[model samples]
Target: MYIPPSSTSPSAQTTTIMSLKTALISYFTFFVVFVDLTLASKHHVINFRSPTLYPESLTWDPSADHFIVGSHRHRTLVSVSSAAAVDTLISDLSLPPNTTIVGVSLDHHRRRLLAVVHSTPPLPIFNALAAYDLRSPHRRRLFLAPLHDPTTDRPIANDVAFDFSGDAYVTNSVGNFIWKVTPDGEPSIFSRSPAFTSHPVDQSLPHSFCGLNGVVYSRKRLPPRRPIKHRQNVQSQRR
Candidate 1:
């Protein structure tokens, strides 16, 4: 057996190693290409044009085949179709000047659209919510309400969610609280967690921001399994 140890040449071993390297490179390239194509097929783009409107939040209307966007600049709710048709659903609310709209949600059962409105100027005020009646004949009925918190000074209405019973819940990013609004527009603090509190300004950067930002609700449904209470959670987007 020792006499036949040198039967294979060095060039033959080098060629075999080169073949394996090439095969590995080919497999890696194919995997990357497959993943890229899979992701690309799942998403697409839609475009619209509104010169004065700076959109911050969007919600889709499945019944009408259009999307509603909240304007931060014009302070309006504009509708954009899939074919790029743009129209103003509600021109303006009774809010103050420099009001910016953020999160929006549709209440199908209540036939209303709720939007989070905040003011930007010398002093920013983010404690307002606006509701529009979707079933109105004129299509412009507007209602504005303020969310108040005596414990925390800064209350920014960031996002909104609804439950099975048509009650609305909103997240206050700066105040670290959740507000509940009834169908009649009455607002009260739902929950306040100390976890959303931010550090002192003097101890950190002057522009540091923190608190609860987004909220969502999930309802339990089962035929014979007795009706359970709806569960909700607040998600903070801190900086």
Candidate 2:
């Protein structure tokens, strides 16, 4: 089951871990936690009650008034409605056989859904960025941005970010780099330096050998901050 915040409140977006064994309904301003289980029923201001397999990430789509979920076991995306209806938003990306869809984000300005595709098997693991058209449900315009790290054996694409220009930036957890995707869906190396190297000095620390996880870009002039998970950051920039 998946729980998406019913409202846009800051408190609603609080980070939570949904236990796969328990079932409960929570209302957050910006976030919702989905535990592993079968949905009982849908109630007021809440829906998306059902069984889901390997749900990895979710993002709220204000235009469609629904939450988009990515499957870690399947390379697909689905939308859950407040009325307890589930719909297939994207699937059959025609990627490699073992690709899994992990992170998802909405590019409101571009009217597109950006996703990270992690491919397993076929040695020297690589990741790709997928873009889907949001103009209509019937048209499945797919664009791919493939990435790899010549220095590392395994590179995992985790999350995505958009700069002020609407260009997409993706986070590589294991490779310690940020990839930039053009509006046309072309991908290129945006930034990769030794500064992103993870030391893993203390096991007790939340730090992981995977350098970076989540990132955010701002239109304001403020400094940009990237969240280093054990994994995320928001910054303001001038438009």
Candidate 3:
């Protein structure tokens, strides 16, 4: 049966068809990753999902002031800045073909970058924590030092963060757990279990959990200091 096209013009129909194809391709390519960039007018843009490749995670480097795009299939990290002609490839790793980057963060003074790679096969749901030392100009690699227990195979990474003290934090979407990665490559728990979670599955029930997605190190305000009055009355020796 010959069905009419959505539009009368042939070009319109062709355009529609092309759009659908692109959408499907994007979905398949970027279903495992999500990114955000706000430097340009095209802010809040999802790079890989727009006729691009398997886009993993997106982040901003204050030093470079550029957007970083990481992918699993490509196993590469690309950076795009307003000054550059196009995205520049930074790191290439031997990670899984279906890996997805969940978070990216940076520390300015220390000249460091942290990334969390979640490896999922046939599905984007595996718990793996990968990081990189972005200070080097020649050495580009994704060093994945597993944080999860070797015994308990869990799901994917949802978020990552770094503190001013060089401490790292990660969120597991499926395991309902959070881990803190030390500067010395040690993994430990940052918060209590169920740290970050999704909404309740029950449609009738109403609840909200802060969906832990991008864990970035930010400047948290310190508590105010107490006022101290030192009254050293010039001891005028009125002897």
Q: Which structure among the candidates has the greatest lDDT?
A: 1
lDDT of 3: 0.62
| Rank ordering of all candidates by TM-score, starting from the highest | 1, 2, 3
Looking at model 2, residue 81 earns an lDDT score of 84
Per-residue alpha-carbon lDDT of candidate 2 for residues 67-109, written as tens digits (9 for 90 to 100)? 8998877767888887768887887657776578888888887
Clash number by candidate, in order:
0, 18, 3
Worst 10 residues of 3 by lDDT: 32-41
Residue 11 C-alpha lDDT in model 3: 82
Q: TM-scores of the models, in the given order?
A: 0.68, 0.66, 0.58
**Reference-based TM-score, model 1:** 0.68
Query: Sorted on lDDT, highest at the top, how do the candidates line up?
Result: 1, 2, 3
Residues 1-239, candidate 3, lDDT per residue (tens digit)?
55576635888778879989999999976754443323334645433332344666767777777877666555566776756434645544466565666666665666666777776656644555555666776645435557674434555566777787888788765455678887776787677544244345553544223234555556978799976544433344332
Candidate 2 accuracy as TM-score: 0.66
lDDT to native, each model: 0.78, 0.75, 0.62
Give the distance in Å from residue 180's predicted Cα in candidate 2 to where it truly belongs.
Answer: 0.6
Candidate 3 accuracy as TM-score? 0.58
